[model samples]
Target: DQQVKQNSPSLSVQEGRISILNCDYTNSMFDYFLWYKKYPAEGPTFLISISSIKDKNEDGRFTVFLNKSAKHLSLHIVPSQPGDSAVYFCAASHGGYQKVTFGTGTKLQVIP
Candidate 1:
């Protein structure tokens, strides 16, 4: 079974709005959570991440929040722009980033 899951396969958001991507995990052993943005014909680039010890982490327009008790996490992008459109993947790993399990991915489209 997939340990990490992204229930929504895709999302659409208007430009200058907020885009929220959600992910869920079944394995509690995961201590670290990460989000990646992938463009067509390119590798996924690390966006933002949060440690299990922290509830939230923010960088510029991107913010990641972890709810360990609920085994849930979310990525929020404020003032979404067209360039922000990409497939976002949620990943989890334990024991210092040895092996990571990735979700199916959520495609985000920001309408201009």
Candidate 2:
């Protein structure tokens, strides 16, 4: 069973548009969260992360917002580019990264 879930399996956005990827979790104890982007054969690469203590975190064109009450989080990519197309995974863990749970993942396609 999966503790984290990404409702949408795929999303398509035009180049230079804003792309939003959403995720929800069943556990409330998860304090640390992370987002990863994966290409075809390679392992997932870290995108952004947020702690439960903070509602939001940002880096460059990437931003992650956490809503503890709703057990939901979202990753927003501004000016989405063709190179940004990949499968994104939402992950969470508690107790200082001892263990992590990942969502099924959402494939994002940025059309040029």
User: How does model 2 fare in lDDT?
Assistant: 0.96
- Candidate 1 residues 9-73, lDDT tens each? 99999999999999999999999999999998999899998999999999999999999889999
Which stretches of candidate 2 lie above 4 Å from their native place?
Answer: none
Per-model TM-score, in order, reads: 0.98, 0.98
TM-score of candidate 2 on Cα atoms, chains taken together: 0.98
Q: How many residue pairs clash in each candidate?
A: 0, 0
- The per-residue C-alpha lDDT of model 1 at residue 83 equals 98
The deviation in Å at residue 45 for candidate 2 is 0.3
